[model samples]
Target: MTQQETHAQEAERRGSFSSRRVFILAAIGSAVGLGNIWRFPYVAYDNGGGAFMIPYLIALLTAGIPFLFLDYALGHRFRGSAPLSFARLRRGTEGLGWWQVGICFMIAIYYAAVIAWALRYTLFSVTEAWGDDAAGFFTGEFLQVSDPGVTAEIVPGVLVPLLIVWAAVVVVMVAGVQKGIGAVSVVFIPLLVITFGALVVRSLFLPGAADGLDALFTPDWGALAEPGVWGAAFGQIFFSLSIGFGIMITYSSYVHRDTDMTGSGLVVGFANSGFELLAGIGVFAALGFMAQAEGVAVDEVAQSGVGLAFIGFPAIISEAPWGAFIGVCFFASLVIAGLTSLVSVIEVVISAVRDKFELGRAQAAALVSIPAAVLSVLLFSSTSGLHVLDILDHFINQFGILLVAVVSMVVLAWVLKVLPLLQNHLNRNGSFRLGALWRILVSVVAPLALTYVLLDGLWNDVRTRYEDYPGWMLGVFGWGAAGLVIVFGFVAARLPWRKDTPMDVTDDEEVQA
Candidate 1:
């Protein structure tokens, strides 16, 4: 092969040895964080009580796994940043690729808004907020204080220490892939898992914990008929798995040809979803027991508020034996889990900047941090940050993940020239082949499924506009659109588009469809 061919091949080999491991753990850590803690138990409280699990699992198998495999195949197949994967996979038609990348990038920025919340909660933990005196503590000192407190007021003796714990994540990324992300994931992912496992063991031992577990596992088949239930299941699957976000594709770009992407994708997906299930077990069992003792069913705590985490969980912990200790475990797990996700989000911004602007590693790192920190402080300073985060999350999940899944399935399954890189690599290694059934899934069924998700999202928007949710929703929708456009503009600007740009076209490759 010529030198050019060799260099192209060499570029195809991205990521350090630890990159794949870091990618899997980091992705799983992002998926398993706030969803398992805040979202699942509350939604489950109302949606089916114990009955939602059936649909959630069905949605997972049908939608989540298929899309997970599809992204793994496409991201590693192209060996480029997400937008590049979509554009490069098929050469000339890069619009959809830009769209996917744009959506992912936007979500990444807004997700920092959520990480800001975790930072706030972590600060609260260090004070006496989770102690048996939590109610008095939160009501008097924590909640009542409006302006940002000193490290001492915010978290007492440990306030500065907690923020540093959160900020050290930025340091990890500053060190780059081989050293920073890999080192953290190796330690933190294991710590997260162990912490979750500890929570589960203690949760099961709680009185009436079995009742909540039964609620999570048992199914009311009648609830399956509710369109909203399916929507919740699908939404949860999309958000909780972190699917359709370009992070998977972006991370996959770092994979070496020798890496087992299918295996790795499964490991990450199952690890994430499994943690989610365990998290449900922990949270619901506690919620159920606590609710029973309080004489209200789980639905009593379903409101989305600052109290959701700060007041709600701490209240439960305060009522329990050695409650302060349990509260410590929960927040500890949250801090590590939050940082793992935080690093990935920051990396998304940094990766896009570096890829598009030809930035050095450190410059790209600082660029992501400065803006993220400023925006986070601005947003959280308002009472509305919590509500805004929820709204942005819904919009991002609905439009971003669903639509990317749609485009990705089409490009990889139909537009791409050959079997996706993972299949090719497996065959190259004489390791494993997906065979005809899996082939059909990658090429056709998966894409079709995403198309349904995509169309449903469009229809949801149209339907909602006619139905007219609150006026505040209009701002959310408007910002969501503007966000996608802004991110895509960044990506599109970076593409080598000459005025006479036929450069968009890559070499001719066969499209299977």
Candidate 2:
């Protein structure tokens, strides 16, 4: 066979997104996860209230979108998963890709548990089943909280829903890129927006909603002067947009070569932010009603994370008119959002394995998903799962995602000296042209801001153990877990690639029409 024929065959072997629109939908699905609903409102309220938007928008433009463009350039130009893409960039950088895959693995194990909780709560929302003691029911009845240590004993409630989540994920993944990931994204993202939007509208009409808005939006202009607030803004954008975790790199790899990536990045960045803004409105509105019903200040009732979703929202559902409907919309949104994001996280590992082993889609999906499903069920379905998850989530985001992001950006921009090449690649078919400004952000501004956030979190964790968990518990799950991903990264990098794997882009294959 001619050389061109071989290249064509290889390209076909690696699937592409059916079109640019599907790619955008899938990217948005990955970006808009549980964080938008639960985390963003509190981050904004704590940072500077209404004034926080200044730093948040600045961070988005200066760091978030620029880093996104970088991911797209690498994936699209290299036409490979994280490992293959980095290997193609420069042979030594493959470890960075595997490091990202390891982070995704750590994330998937615990992330599914949260989705499972949301799934159960979606049904529980119907009857206000917690019966006024929302927190008690979540910790005692539902999870049956045990002491903070690993145990083999499982919570039947958690186990069942978690099993369902993993089963759904396995099926989607085995279906391949467009048929599975792309199709799910197209359907679920719109449903999430519509359902969540209806919830938001209902929230705004609640009696204390204006009070909640007042509390959330009342900007302390002075917060703008604080270094920590700005740091928080950058941190939120980094985590919210899913930039550092190899998700965008893997997703962008599936798009057609001629796609307008920069323009798409803008759409995604803005869309994710728009959803977060809507979330802030909906969440605080509900909190306002909760506070009023309890005869307390909004701050007294405000919460985030698992507390906000499982404990706090359940209480709201118990009291409000049309309470059952609100609960359904809210928890269903969480399930949909979490599912989309979880699928993307699992796909990163699947794609890396596929590229490295030259496995077919079914083989790679099964190889990655089966073990992941088993591990997820084992670790997160137990009485101690919540404690373990809490530590892993905290440590992984701070040390795993943020640290790698900084290192990769510095290495790509300064060590490998490929920002210019990547910029050229992006601009080739991009609607928006990148220049020195983009380079400055990727190389200088982003790394410095992220480094500050990383060190700040590290120091705080060291000074005070996260949540005052037992020292051994923190040691095992927090620091120990964070350290293991880095170890896995370099170790996996040393493993053999399939002999026939195309590790570098050939000259004729550099730019596809």
Candidate 3:
């Protein structure tokens, strides 16, 4: 049988999302994570405050959602994970899919550790256990963080929770799509919104909340002229929406054939942005209150990434009314958001492995999770683990994810000349018709934007040691980690695709075979 014929049969064996709503919720859950809550607010504030929204929204419509639609069409049309789907597109491109999946593998391991930290802090919020020195506690006392280059013993505080996180994720994967991933996302996404909504409402009433809102939305119009601002906006949209990780492709593969592809992409995009905007409001309001209490500038208290979540927010919680309660809700929301996204991240690898090997879901889950869990525990559970996580996360996201995205767009828009084909599929299966504009966005706008970001990032890295870490450390954890992703991608792609018990195609209308 031809490759298409085999893929057609495999579609029947691969499980599906139970409904359109479930699929959308899962997609939203994947998109709305720590980036929305911890990263977006800071990024918006720095890039021109309220003024940044213009560029951000522009990127979302032109680049973010367009790429989203492309992934949806590819996955729905091909009915496989990134490897199988890309292989279907063209024989040699299968390695790119594995490369994308490799990036996902890197993300999933470190991401679980971050989620584990949130879990620990949720319990710590009970008494503001970090006391007055939030930073000291996080690094010196709690983590016992070693010197950057030194490897320290595991910290139980991080390790115990990380194990739970891995187990929970494994359970969800093993539960199968509808009962496991779909069901959890349905519950978690709503709960995440409600919890954060209540936090936002309470925050809006706090003294100095307006100051935080001002910092978030008060636009410095002149900043718009800077190239960096535009770059930031585009970067934020790309990273925030969970594109480029084989996630949307993997998720959309399970979507029902009759589902509205265009509508689904729009819904996921808008939902992600909506949550991000809401998160900005809540985060800034709390920071404003913190700034007021400290008699400092909002920028002094504002931060992003692990610093913002663990240090700055803990300080804010320590002073607020019912501080303990608010702290619990805040960290709990982070855990929920992180877990949902983690599920999608791991699923990318799981789906790829299952498709490539023709293994059962449970078997694929075990193969992926066991190594990922071990790496999470061994590397991140150590006192130096946070340092390693920071370095790897930076390099992987900058060099790995962004580069893969640029290449994927190039192959689709230029190499294959398939934008028209993908556009037709979207219009036929979706309520909304994608026209010349969509094609232009994918072919012209997105690639240029992504390419600029990639170049800027490379320049920045070459100029300085990230965070002032030693050059050797950066080489080991930063560039070295990224290089390994490409190496593994080709290695995994070279493995034999399963031939036994080819998947039976229940519906071949959308599939090429």
Per TM-score, the best of the predicted structures is: 2
Clashing residue pairs, backbone N/CA/C < 3 A, model 1: 50-215
What lDDT score goes with residue 118 in model 1? 47
Model 3 lDDT per residue over 1-513, tens place: 875666545656788899999999999999999999999999999999989999999999999999999999888877788888788777678888999898999999999999999999999999789999999999988888998884748898888999999999999999888889999999999999888898898888778889999988999999999999999999999999999879999999998777899999999999999999999999999999999999998989989989999999899888898788778889999999999999999999999988887588899999999999998898999988888899999999999999999988988888888888778777877887899999899989998998999899999989877999888889988999899889888888788887663333324333332
Query: What TM-score would candidate 1 get against the native?
Result: 0.80
Runs of candidate 1 exceeding 4 Å displacement: 1-15, 19-23, 42-54, 93-101, 130-166, 302-308, 414-432, 439-473, 476-483, 486-494, 497-513
- RMSD (Cα, Å) of model 1: 5.3
Instruction: List runs of model 3 lying over 4 Å from the truth.
Output: 1-9, 150-152, 500-513
Poorest 10 consecutive residues of model 1 by lDDT?
Answer: 500-509
lDDT of 1 by residue, 80-164 (tens): 5555565555554455556655555455445554444445555565454446655455444543333322112232322333335
lDDT of 2 by residue, 416-511 (tens): 888888898888889999999999999999999999999999999988879989999998889998999999999999999987776547534343
Q: Candidates' TM-scores?
A: 0.80, 0.98, 0.96
- lDDT against the true structure, per candidate, is 0.60, 0.92, 0.89
Least accurate stretch of 10 residues (summed lDDT) in model 3? 504-513
